[model samples]
Target chain A: MPKESDDLSTLGELGESAVLGRIFPRLPAASAQLLGPGDDAAVVAAADGRFVVTTDLMVHGPDFRLAWSLPHDLGWKAAASNLSDVAAMGAVPTALVVAIAAPADSPISLLEGIADGFRDACGALAPGCGIVGGDLSVSDTLTIAVTAFGDLAGRPPVLRSGARPGDVVAVSGALGEAAAGLRVLFAEALDANGAPDAVLASLVRDRTTAQLTPSPPIADGPLAASAGATSMVDLSDGLAIDASRVARASGVRIDFDRGALGADPDLALGGGEDHSLLATFPPGARLPGGFRPIGTVVAPADDEGNVSVILLDGKPYTVSGWDPYTGWKDSGVAGGSAG
Target chain B: MPKESDDLSTLGELGESAVLGRIFPRLPAASAQLLGPGDDAAVVAAADGRFVVTTDLMVHGPDFRLAWSLPHDLGWKAAASNLSDVAAMGAVPTALVVAIAAPADSPISLLEGIADGFRDACGALAPGCGIVGGDLSVSDTLTIAVTAFGDLAGRPPVLRSGARPGDVVAVSGALGEAAAGLRVLFAEALDANGAPDAVLASLVRDRTTAQLTPSPPIADGPLAASAGATSMVDLSDGLAIDASRVARASGVRIDFDRGALGADPDLALGGGEDHSLLATFPPGARLPGGFRPIGTVVAPADDEGNVSVILLDGKPYTVSGWDPYTGWKDSGVAGGSAG
Candidate 1:
């Protein structure tokens, strides 16, 4: 076997079992978890007698890079991505299964770091959400896939299709922080030597932390469901795009107040991976705490089978949100246009 | 952006969404599935109101390779690995989520093939179990991570630690086929130019198929459970190793009839990835069809917690099973003594 020092930067630094050991200790115990890591499978309690499931994968390079993230960051990000999906449905995350592929020659410390990352995210974001079980295999590159399970606690799940035309649009948590963080990380002017130490540290911290590991507003999701939110989604593909999904699913148009969105419009409209809860409520329904009103669901315009995002002044925004199929580029925002 | 002929053989050849599209259609539709693939996450109906979850990762090189297997095989293997865990619990598979990492230069056709592999495996073994959601990203090598969910149908789950002395040891399905197949694939003699077409085809087929895609006996697992088997496990790490686990957990020593292990003893004892079901039953319990009596559970002779597997004439076979931490060669029959 190669010495850890020889490839400490790679995932081979830590062995799979050792990596799991590091993360397992940090996880909180959940009542719903019948079995946690170290078994063939995890047994979780389904209080409502139904389980909610979601999965997401993170690959080194396209999704992330070693130069931009630490192993722990990657782990945290992997867990958060799936956990957020569970949260999107107003479900309580119960357990997570992680499968990681890395090169044999990669340092084992990288795997340890990745496990730590996953544990850290699950620890803080969804306490008691243990790493139930997973598989490890050697690969040419680093890849982490996480599957998360959640419980509905016997309540009907709040889906994106539940929003009605008269529903009030609202959001929990700030938008664009992750996107802004990414921007600062990629900004040429913020290089280590050129930028102020404090500013650079803060920027790097936010950028690397948020970009590498997202913090999903899981707590607010169940609260929204309790507050009778009509429809909801986790803002992964920017607000405009995801909100459009809700609008189209509910057969309604959504109108957003530019003032309510953060100072950066791109963060609200074009930013991806924030994982904030975007929800809608009946006009008179009780709203959850920390939820800020952002927009309103409205009747569709002349376009058939389409959901458009109108601006504060009742004009449509010409620029659509991010599309994975189409390359991303800067575009001027316009009023009264369909996305 | 690269053409198919550009030699990029990486994951980029298959776009992430496109890969999902191929596998989504081939899965069996389960009534427990509230939503199938093509969404942010799949919602599965947990019949007992709970779920059994597990995950496994397949990485190129350590787990598989392009030279030895095709992309489709990797997909099937990844899904099967996790599905085996769910089966180990005597649960019915409900849904699956996959995370794939590949190089950008890979041909899209390879991704489609991988998806097809997943579909094929699910169709044959886990009908109604589909890849409901997944993430795709570029990496240096091909990595597949699959998370599987299962429903228990309200039966008390059979755990590994429930065995007792005097319990009859039995197995469902074939043993050692995968390990034997692997050996055939690696043997130099089999690669000779003038090898018989039928024999060579069977050998190659067994080796290639077993190595690339292991079919876990999911059906037989629940069957054993319904038959009142005391303790059960999936033959993932090999019979001796996994049986020892049952012995240790149940606080009993297990003795096996070497002659009854089938035509090949090595295949039965130390073969890994056969994905057969091993269970312990009461002495007078009626054994289910397809279940072959192999041994008897007895009290541990020593305090070391070592479970002995004796021969038919009462001779001790000291060889243990495979351990991931240890090299595969050391755990084989030829290299080590049976315990």
Candidate 2:
């Protein structure tokens, strides 16, 4: 932490305007934005008479640890997570409104880096989606809450409840990568006192970056929708759990082939934070380029009296999904609580 | 705080689904919603092909104190603050996406009350606006981040930059009320340890509720826009400060009449957080029913070399606006830091 006397300016020292002045320039301008920041509110072009909206929060403790993830990685993951939601709705993300509350003593560079990350992530993952407005606040906890908007482009929104009995369940992007990366970070990137070691975390950059800065297959969502997809969901939770959601919502059962899953089937089944797109497409339809068939949607067997919504190779598979409340622990590995 | 075994279940004990199941039922259905919660994203109708969007944050420390504010008040204020932004854009608020991150120990009833507050606030303030989507996270600090979206309704967005030299600056909603209420809270609602006392706060309900659950003239925004108002801004800051923003944005000077401002002229000018709409209309144009003329937009005296954008009875007034970063202190009077 750089002192106020040094070159690095803390948020407390610079105030909101100065800090925003540094960050506003770094953010990418959204093409869909009619009126951008600096006003009471920003106006974004919905274009098709409707807009897809979703909000997500990343708190300091449960979401990510500053030790394991840098400001850039946090921003990237935050944007990636929200953009994936819009994509899952089969909409092109147009703009995002980000509200970040950080400790007053935090360096202004933290916000600047986060802004740059937002700019780059939008450039790479969801091209043309940019931040239109945001709010800043002072808090003991560093919290990033992002609300994302998207344009449907005249396509009907792909919903989780649209899957049918004959639908083929497919996935886009890496399933177990983020979870595997988190496990590696927990196992390798801890200091002597059990705190996360950023330096050591960076040493396993390949693994850690996946957990810190996931690139969800954003374009695949609209493609899946365009290719006569029935239901779509962002796989923020593991394959089994998210698939179960689609199954439950659609009144169907999802049967996954073990062979379709990668080498670490258990990790693919139970681990989460992958942010992939899980969609149910019509059988025999060309699976979008980025998507691969992983499972099949089957009619629920009412006579069998089995309550399971997920099956692995014709057997009942029960696995829990990510619930922030139940999933969080006071002090844990990987992204531990800052407090 | 309720124990785990009590009738009131903590968030950690009930898990995310159960908590969400409780909150989802309490929220009002938005008329503009095509797809509501329990999905990847919500779809809202932007009838005119564009949506006015904004986001605002209320962190526990700098924004409010749980000791002084009930969960319902917190929810209402959060929604009110964000809705005002959309209203200031001269658009009708249609939906809100609220993300709340609270401690794991927080009771499910806290979220339930917040939901009820959001329900009631949207019902009373912005009739058709309702919660569309939201996210929850575990955090030490209680944070409420709200993003509001509005429909243009085929009208041009009233912008801060649109105030011209001859525009009659007016305000809709009470000025200095919230700030005065905050002063009352700081003056009376404190215990021996300098912490807020809810019991004491309740005694001054009239004063404190203005600071807690402010009902900004949400309807007056679109009304002003329809009435041919040239410019508009939400008075989240003081009249002098927010007017200065309009002045700066429009490249004009704003001169306020001291007599027109209620009895407490200085308080009305310098105090903040009224959430009122400060708008400018064409000279001699009939002011909206709720709007009262307070000032006038004048040509900037470039030759005089004075850069101050705001004036009170022909004299320069440069009162500062709210800045969470610079304004916050570790421990203060009204809504002090919980840490």
Candidate 3:
């Protein structure tokens, strides 16, 4: 829990306007915003006459536990996750509209910290991209829902279905670090009875930071698009699963060279939440900076049913990605709180 | 609880992909969509080089009760609420990106009904505006967060601060009906102990329907803009409070003729969630067909503090708007479930 301060008030004490007043100043201003908060809606410049949009939700129980994530980390992760989606469309993020629902007793400092995180994340990851507007509600669960918008800059969107048989699959940003971080957190968080212990903090800071606040290569998306990437996807649900998505969409099979994947290839293949850019470039084409060759697209086998096929060193890789519902039950976290 | 059927499997039974497969077919197609769902993000056309964006959250406890709100009603109300913000900007809604977080055991039919609600709401309220993309997550509380986008269509956005002294205050769509409906629902929902029984339906079907499924005059917004509305606001809050917002924003005091507010002016002044469009037109300007004049804006009084001033037939109207945090406690509706 956040340290209680006499200066800090709770949402229950300070009404919506007062809470927003405290947060708005901490947020970064959007370059594309024509109108910001305090209105019914915000107007953003979609300079290219088309904009890419996506939304993602981070809920308290399933997505993150307050014990594991600070308010700042929650905001950073939420913004980074949604921003990665906008980048995956091969678009430069322009603005974000965030909606948060938290318990009435949540401190004003929590929201202020969230706003600061949004400011810093946008400043670091995608300069000029900032929060345009937001809404707040009182709820039992702390839910953060963000919708990000991006400007394509007149380039055609690079889609998952556009890959061909001979394309080389490349990935930008770290693959397995985030999942490794999650493991570190879980191991440290669990008590003797295997239930989560809220008091514990992960000793592995780097891996924990990667899991908590990932910095996806936002610029690499448009760079790959400019370099004529045939297909692209954000590595949100592990390399193997996301690669299969591209392969299935493109009617091909992906074969990964185990050596090409960094030192822990198994973790790279099965771990999730890296938010890396995975793009397929034509053979012999110049790979964009930050992207490393990971796999190759091949024709689907005739006898095998038309299903997602992923191969690791010429053998079928059967490991799957994260699924929230099943994962929640499988993890045995039990409830919303450790207490 | 929704009726159980052999075909209606729960979300836990069918993973995200299968659940999405069921919902995708039921959602309406967006005319402004360049690329739709199933991608990392959706691309939407912003023909005039700008788009209006807004987000809202509807959570289970403070926002609605599942006992009273059917899945379809939840979906319809959520869409209508967000769409009204887009309309309030004097823009035509083009697309929505929705993110929903529900318990793992939630029925797939609940999602299907929500999808159907989105389809029907878009069909009736804002034709051609549909769900372009969405995300799903598992949570203890069922939360629906919607971000709506609208095309400006080459018109200057009508802002809340644009109203000038001598402007005629006008409104389109009925006020207080939704709040009245809430009152009806509360009366019927409470048992002998004054706790929510969650069994009885409101006797006043029209009022309950009004509260559950509102049809705000969306088209009148642009019409009012075309007829030269100086300022505009969506009346999700009570008329007195929303008018106060306009009064405060424009640095003007609004004097409303109580008789102009249909029967039960007190209800009109204090009730909320009607989602009506409240606009100001310059004196002698032609009021749009559906808009009825309710009040007039005047210069701020020299003696009164520089705060929101709203007069109901010359006396100060002290009733405040809804604050979710305070209202959640004030209503005495404890816990997520009635049980």
* C-alpha lDDT of all candidate models, in order: 0.69, 0.85, 0.84
- Model 1 chain A scores worst on lDDT over the 10 consecutive residues at A327-336
- lDDT per residue for candidate 2 within B25-88, as digits (tens), equals 7888899999999999999999999999999888887888888888888888988888899999
* Predictions in order: chain A TM-score: 0.84, 0.94, 0.93
lDDT per residue as tens, model 2, A107-149: 8878877887788899999889999999888988888889998
lDDT per residue (tens digit) for residues B1-339 in model 1: 111122343333343445445445644466567766544566777768678888877665555646566666776777777777887787888777777666566676566667777777887887877766666665667677778888878877778888888899998766887777666655622336633233444446645566557777777667777888888888877787788778767777788887788897756787787777788888989887578889988876765644354433355666555433334223232222443
What lDDT score is found at residue A221 in candidate 1? 80
DockQ score for candidate 3: 0.81
Q: DockQ for each candidate?
A: 0.45, 0.85, 0.81
List the candidate 3 regions with Cα displacement exceeding 4 Å.
Answer: A1-6, A193-195, A304-308, A331-339, B1-6, B193-198, B202-204, B304-308, B331-339
Stretches of candidate 1 off by over 4 Å are: A1-23, A105-109, A188-203, A206-208, A305-313, A318-339, B1-23, B188-203, B303-336
**Per-residue lDDT of candidate 3, residues A1-339 (tens digit):** 223234567898998888887778788889999999988999999999999999999988777778777777888899899899988888999999999988899888778777777888998899999999999999888999999999999999989999998989999999788888778777777778876555675445555888888999999999999999999999888888788888889888998988998898888887788899999999999998799998899989786774448887777777565777667655322111001
Error of 3 at B39 (Å): 0.7
Better of 1 and 2 by TM-score: 2
Please give, for residues A185-266, the per-residue lDDT of candidate 1 as tens digits.
6563245664323344454674455665778778888788888888888887677777777876777778888778768664
**Where's the lowest-lDDT run of ten residues in candidate 2 chain B?**
B330-339
Worst 10 residues of 3 chain A by lDDT: A330-339
